[model samples]
Target: MIKKSMLVEKITRRTIGFVLTMLILSIGVFYLSRLAPGDPLQSFYGDAIESMSTEELDAARIRLGLDSPVYVQYVKWISNAFQGDFGLSLKYKMPAMAVITPLIGNTLILGGIAYILVFALATLLALFCAMHEDTLIDRIICKVGTAAYYIPPFWLGVVLVLIFSVNLGLLPSSGAYSVGKSDDILNRIQHMILPLVVMILSHLWYYAYMIRNKLLDEIRKDYVLLAKAKGCTKTEIVLKHCFRNVAPTIVNIMAISIPHVLSGTYIAEAVFNYPGIGALSVQSAKYHDYNLLMLTVLITGVLVIASSIIAQSVNEVIDPRIKLMEESP
Candidate 1:
């Protein structure tokens, strides 16, 4: 009962924190959108804002509600954004949702696949190395993981493109699909293979090494020794004792990695020309599409902050030590 109550308190705190974070970020987004030096009209319609007729200019401002006071504009925007409307894109000349929807879908697909693969493979490999600490296999895995982790992501992407797409010609060099004409699972996977591999290879090593180190340290705890003394099997001790204990750390690492992985996808997207949010974000930055850039940043920031809060709440729940430490006299 006490544990349930504590868990409820933790979830309530995290939920409140997430709402506060999104509110703050939305305000920041609104203010930052107004701060862009060049007008979106100039950037989108060519730098002839003064030459544009009153009708044309008013039409443009009206389209974006830019004619309103900043606070009023922000209030309306917050209302619409809550309803999943981000207004029209100045550059794309379509609803911002229209321009962003497919790209967001692509990003979620790629990011989700890579994150699951990285985390699962990293956890398994780390467990193996931790179990075999100080052995030849451990040394080799550690060295290789360290080396892979330190290499630049773009460099890895390039090398992957060169080998799989260029040299082998086995996969599409740059695209989310092969000209978008088929729904065959095999064809879709073939198109997905290169970018997915690039993402996994670029990220898996660092997480593997971190988890391995943490699990190794955790395996030496007195509780683990006591579990072993009770005649628990090796798998039981590692799985139930060590893995459960380290799960919170893994969650924390994943929460921190979410933002980075989101940003880092841009390199892979740029290399492969995949139609994901990362590529879209880069285009927005280059073209100075303040609205699109702000929207992307705002959304990504909310997800990252929410994940962080969730991780913290999970930490508080799983590790009663934290609550106790905080409550110490």
Candidate 2:
């Protein structure tokens, strides 16, 4: 009963912290959007408005409600955003959601597949390295993973494009799928191959290294030694004992990787012209489209904070030491 009450209290506190972080991040995003130079409306108008007088510009500003005070504008934007409205995109001249939702779908498709693939491969590779620690296989895996880790995704995408698309004609150089092609599973999978490969190559290394190090650390612990002394098989010791003990650390790394996944995909999206959230964000930022840019960032911020909170909570679950420490006082 005491543990249950404590858990509830901890959850409540974490919820409050998450909400506070979200509020601060939202305010920062709001203010930074205001501080950026150039008008979003101007991106819509461009130099085509050179002949327009100040009166015309002011009139246009009023029409867009850009003439309002910053605070009033923010309040209105926030209120509308909460109701599933993010205003019209100056670039697309459509509802912001119309422009963003499809991009988000593309991004999730890419990122979700990449994250799962990279994580699974990294886990296996890291386990292999851990099992063969100090062997030739371990050394080779370490060197290769490290090398791949240092290679940027964009450069890797270019190389893949040259080899697979240009030379062998095995893959398309750009586009999520062939234009006007139906959204068939096979077509989507074919499009995913390049970006997925790029992602796995660019991302798997770090996780491999981290997991390998974690496994090595776990193997050295006194509990692991005791398990070995108790006649546990090698596989049992490694999987049931070591992996379980290191689960929290691995999960923490994954949580940290969430934000990086978003940032990393930007280069991949740009290289392949994948039309994901990363590409949309890049376009929005370049064009100074406040609505889309701010909305994207706001979503990213929420995800980051929420992921962190979740990771912390999960970590506590995997490692009772965290709960004990929290309960200490």
Candidate 3:
């Protein structure tokens, strides 16, 4: 009963924290939008703003609620947003959601595939390095992982495109899909390869290095030595003892990485012209479309919070001691 109560309390606190975070983020974005230079009307009228009469400009201001005080406009916007209305995009002249919805799927596809590949390869390589510790293979992988982690993703992406798409003519350089061609799954996969590779290479080394250090620490613990004294093989010790003990730290690292991964995807998508939220965000900024930008920021905030909640929940399941420790004081 006490454990159950503790679990509920932890969940309640996390839920409250999530709500507070969203509120603060929304308010920040709201004010930042107002502070940004440039007339929102320019997105609609361009240089024609100079030709419009005073009455016409005022009418446009009133239409967009820009005529009101900033706080009043913020209140109206927050109220409307709660009801699922995010306003029209100043650039596209469509509802903000209409502009954002289709691009989300493309981002999820690119981000999701890259995330899985990175974690899988990182884990395997970390394990390999951990078991071999200080040997030639371990030293080589550490050097490689360090180099890969430090290389900028965009620069690496450009290099990959030059080599694979331009010089070798092996893959398409830009865009998510071939225009006017059938959108087959294989064709989509082909276009996805370069971005996916970029994402993985950018992240894989850092995670592997992190995991290797974590596993090494775990292997030094008394429990691991006890298992070794009981005749456990090196492989058995790593798999059964070190990995299990390090899992929570790994989960925490992954949780924190979720936002970075999304940001990286944005850059990668823009470079590849992948038509994902990242590319859309770039276009939105170019055209001064704050409604779309605000929505994207809100979505990113939610994702970060959600990832934290997931990591906390997984930690509780894998090591209930964490909950007890928090509850103790």
Candidate 4:
């Protein structure tokens, strides 16, 4: 009964946290976007804004609800948002959510694949380096990974385009799909390759290095000492004891990595011209598309916050001590 109560309390706290985060994110993005130097009228009315008289401009402002005070605007927005109405995209001239519905999938595809591959490869790379220790291979990996991690993702992306897309003519350089092949799975994969290369190369080593260090730290613990005194080999202790205990730390790393990997994913989209939320965000910001921009930022914020919560839950499962500690008197 106590366990159930603790579980309920945890869920309640997490749920409240998620709601508050979205509220703060929405307010920040909304206020900042409005305060930024730009005529949102230009976004909605395009060149028509240039020709409008004062009366017409005021009418336009009134029509779009931009004539109100900032707080009043926010209140209206938040109230409508709760009812599943996010308003029309000023630039796109459609419901903001409608504009996002299609493009989000591409981002998910790129981000999901990159997220899985990065963690999986990082773990394997960490394990290899951990097992190798101070060998020549380990030193080489450390140097190469550090260098790769430091290279700006956009510049690396450009170079990849020059090599494989321009010089060798091997891969599609931009866009999520070739013209008239939206549903072609193989073609979609081809488009994803270069962006994936950028995303993975940018992030692969950062997590790997951290995990490698964590594994090494775990290897030095008292339990590992006990295992060693029991005649366990280095490999046996690392695989059986060290790595097992480090699973919670690895989960934590993965949780915090959402934002890191997401930034890389956005960079990949912008560089590759992928028709994902990243590219859309760039467009929205450039055009001062207020509704579209807010929705996009909120979506991104939710992913990051939710990942942390999910990681906490996973850690509770992997190491029950986490739950007991949090729930203790």
Candidate 5:
């Protein structure tokens, strides 16, 4: 009963922390986006903004609720946000949430696939490297992975586009799906190939290297030596002992890495013109779509913050000592 109460208290504290963090994040994003030198009016009115009189501009700002002080605008936004009104995207002239809602699914599709592939491949690669450790295959993998790690995602994306889309015409160069063929799985996958490949390659080796090092470190631990003394072979020692111990570490790293892989997804979207939230993010930032930008950033923060909380919970399950450590006085 005591432990259960403590767990509830702990969860309550983290809930408060998450709310505070997001509140601060929204404030910062709201103020900084406003301070950035760009006319939100231009996004709304287009080239006509240039031809409007000063009085007309003033009226436009008033109409859009931008004539007030920054703090006042935030108060209004936060209140409206709680009521499910995120305002209009200046560029799209629609509810900001509506503008980005469909795009979120596209991003999830692209990001989810990349997330699974990168970690799965990295784990396999890490295991291979850990088992081989200093053999020719291991050295070759280390050198090649390091090289791939350094290559910029956008550059890699362009090269893939040129080779696959331009030269052989084997894959699409842009969009989440071909026009009006969104339901065709093959067509969607074809479009996703280049961007997804770039996102994977950009991050694959970096994580593989980290996981490889972690596995290697685990193999040197006293427990692994004991296992080996008990007649475990190299393969058995690594697969059974090292990998098991390293699983929690892998989960933790991958959780913290949400933002990193997310940024790569954004870069991929920009380069390939995939119609995801990442692409919308670029557009909103470029065009000063404040309402749209606010929602995008807030959504991203929710993902990152929620993932970290989930990681902690999972860690406590994987190793109860984590819960004990936190609960200790």
Candidate 6:
């Protein structure tokens, strides 16, 4: 009963914390949006905007509620957002959600696939390097991971496009799909390959190196030594003891990587012209589309909070001591 009560209390606190976090993020983003240079109206009228008189520009600001004080605007925005209204996109001149909703699925597919591949490849490489220690393979893995770590994603992406798409004519260079092509599963996969590879390569090296170092530290612990003395083979010790002990750290690292993954997704999508949130984000920024940009910021903020909550929950389950420690304060 006490444990149940503690669990309920923890969840309640987390809920409140997440709400506060979102609120603060919304406020910050709102202010920053105001600070961004250029009038949103310019996106609509371009240089022709100069022909409009001062009164007309003021009327346009009034229509968009941009003439209001910042705090009032924030209150209106937050209130409407709570009710599933994010206002209209200044650039697109349509409801913001109408523009954002479809692009979300594309981002999920791209980010999800790359995320899974990164973890899988990193885990295998880390395990191999850990088991091999200072052998030739371990040295090579370290060197390769270090090199990959320093290679910028944009440059790597451009190089891959030149090789695979331009020179070899093997893959589509840009966009999510071949226009007017049948939307078959195989066709979708072909379009996804290059961007997916870029995303995976950008993240894989850091994670693999981190896991290898952590595993090496775990292998030297007393528990691992005891297991070894108890007739456990190196593989058995690593698989049964070392991995379990390192699991919480791995989960924490993965959680921290969520934002980086999102940011990388944006860059990758832009480079590949994939019609995901990242590409939309670029357009939104270019046009000073406040509503679309705010919506994007809200979604990204929610994902970060969600990832953190998930990591905390996983840590608690992996070792109840974490729950106890958290509950203590």
RMSD of each: 3.5, 2.0, 1.8, 1.1, 1.0, 1.3
User: Which regions of candidate 3 are displaced past 4 Å?
Assistant: 1-10, 180-183
* lDDT (Cα) of model 2: 0.84
Which residue pairs overlap in candidate 5's backbone? none
For candidate 1, the clash count comes to: 0
Alpha-carbon lDDT of model 3: 0.87
C-alpha positional error of residue 311 in candidate 3 after TM-score superposition, expressed in Å: 0.9
Of the two candidates 1 and 4, the one with more favorable TM-score, higher being better, is 4
Q: lDDT per residue, candidate 4, 23-129, as tens digits? A: 99999999999888989889999998888999999999999999999999999999999999998899989999999999999999999999999999999999999
Steric overlap count per candidate: 0, 0, 0, 0, 0, 0
Q: Which ten residues in a row have the lowest lDDT in candidate 5?
A: 319-328
Following a full C-alpha superposition, what root-mean-square deviation does model 6 have from the true structure?
A: 1.3
Candidate 6 residue spans exceeding 4 A from truth = none
**Candidate 2: residue 265 Cα off by (Å):** 1.6
**How does model 3 score by TM-score?**
0.94
So what's the TM-score on candidate 4?
0.97
Residue pairs that clash (backbone atoms under 3 angstroms), model 6: none
Q: lDDT for model 5, please.
A: 0.93
TM-scores for candidates 1 onward, in order: 0.83, 0.93, 0.94, 0.97, 0.98, 0.97
**Candidate 5: stretches off by over 4 Å:** none
> Which stretches of model 4 miss by more than 4 angstroms?
none
The alpha-carbon deviation from the true structure for residue 111 of candidate 5, after best TM-score superposition, in angstroms, is: 0.5
Clashing pairs in 1: none
> Positional deviation of 158 in candidate 6, in angstroms?
1.0
Model 5 collision count: 0
